[model samples]
Target: MQIVHSPLHLRHDGGMELHRGALVPCYEMPARAEYIREALVEAGHALVVPRDFDPEALLAVHDADFVAFLRTAHARWREDGRDGFMLPSGFPARGLRRDRVPSGISGAMGYYAFDAGTPIVEGTWDAAFAAAQCAMTAAALVAEGERSAYALCRPPGHHAGRSVYGGYCFLNNAALAAQQLRERGFGKVALFDVDYHHGNGTQDIFWERDDVLFVSIHGTPETEYPYFLGYADERGAGAGEGFTLNLPLPRGTGWDTYDAALDTALQRIADFGADALVVSLGVDIYEGDPISAFKLGAERFPQLGARLASLGLPTVLVQEGGYAVREIGTNVAGVLGAFGACR
Candidate 1:
């Protein structure tokens, strides 16, 4: 499998994040991708830097205004004479007027963000755009008939929505890859997000489109980080009515339980008869993950890959959340190795 990557991912080095009521060093660090890159190199997989694509590639899935805000957010913060990372102090959630756009940087931050977890560093836009390019490049490889490809995206997406950014995510990488595949002539695509947290942003982007089916198996929203969504009852709406599937598992879930949900998700993809598959591969479900509740063991990671390989579709594995820095490399390698070996 070809691994798509870029050094520009290191640009987004936000030092801190607001989590669990305290300001902590950001868990989504650059080393995460470095570790995975090391593992891929050791396993004899070749890494390729992605070429720059037009912003319209991103505009295909994200709102143009939101993309513009990300590109200028740091500059705006600097213009306002701020010193640290740019973070949203509030959100226009629930009954608020989200229609009108704000002119000031602070108000724009609140208007466009969903939470404070995603802080914008000086290189945030560059890193996020590069990561999206990595995903798109991998998707193009799959479109060109490569069996599968891997995109080691940092500032892990699946959290950023069409017009909102949070959860350490600025752009929805996996969603963009799926959209790229659709643009490349794939009639149907399946996005299976196996992150510990729900891919709220991905679901939001494709929730109304039948061309791409989105399935997420995550911690139940009632007790997870993203508390507003990820319920099993949240099927899609309008033309997307039955195209979305959510399998929200309880905390402390392990392979025995997770395997079942994954099987169900894979079955849905098979039934949908999609032309390609995109896996939002997040190793955060590992038992040692500091911020997550799943109990999946190291040995079980390969099984996750094997199951996905059973589908036999052109796949793009986009990197997402995995906070246990030490084991993140091994766990991610496990999935990719097994998937490639199975093929």
Candidate 2:
């Protein structure tokens, strides 16, 4: 498998986030991607830099105004004479006007962002754009007949919706990759998100379309991050009815339960008769992770990969959340290595 990455990802180095009523150091750091890159290299997987793509590729999945805001928010913050990372102060909640975009940078931040965890730094746009490029490159490789490819994206996307950014994700990299596969001639694409959190952005993008199926197995939204979506009842809408599948596990879930959920997700993908596959690979399910609540061991990653490989469809693996700094690389590489070996 060809692993696509970019050093530019280091640019969006966030400073802090709002967690547990305190501003703590951000868990989604640049070091997450570096650790994965080093492990993949040590494991003998070839790494390649991503090529540039037009902005239209981004507009295909994200809102134009939202993308523009992400590109200029940092500059806007600087124009306001602010220093350090720019985090949202508040959000448009019930009874607030959600239709209008605010004029000031502070209001705009809250308008476009869903949480305070994702900070907009000077290099956020460039780094996020590079990460999207990596995902697109990996998708291109898979569309060109490679059995599978890995996109080592940082600022993990999945929490990002069509027009809102949060959960330390500015761009929905996995959604972009799935869209690329569709434009590259795949008739039907199945996007399976194995991240610990629900891919609300991905689900939002395809919620009304039948061409791409979205499936996720994550912690129950009733007691997890991004606690609005990811219920079993959210089975898609309009033309996409029955195309989306969500298997919400409980807190402290281990390999046995997670494995059963994976089987159900994989079966749904197979039933969809997809021409290609995209996996939003997040390894935060590891018991060692700081911000997440799961109990999967490091050794089970290979088993997870092998299960996905059993589908036998061309796949693109896009990196997502995993906050255990030291073990992140090993867990992610283990999945990739096992997938490659099985393929």
True-vs-predicted CA distance for residue 64, candidate 1, Å? 0.7
Report the C-alpha displacement of residue 245, candidate 1, in angstroms: 0.3
In candidate 2, what are the lDDT values of residues 147-190, reduced to their tens digit?
99999998788888899899889999999999999999999999
Error of 2 at 218 (Å): 0.5
- Show pairs that collide, candidate 2: none
Q: Model 1 over residues 1-343: C-alpha lDDT tens digits?
A: 9999999989988888889789999999999999988988998999998867999889888999899999998899999898778878877778988889779999999998888778898999999999999999999999998999999998899998998888999999999999999999999999999999999999999989999999999999999978888999989999999999999999999888998998899999999999899999999999999999999999988999999999999999999999999899999999999999999
Candidate 2: give its CA RMSD in angstroms: 0.7
lDDT of each: 0.92, 0.92
lDDT at residue 156 of model 2 (Cα atoms): 81
Segments of candidate 1 deviating more than 4 angstroms: none
TM-score of 1: 0.98
lDDT of 2: 0.92
- The alpha-carbon lDDT assigned to residue 16 of candidate 1 equals 82
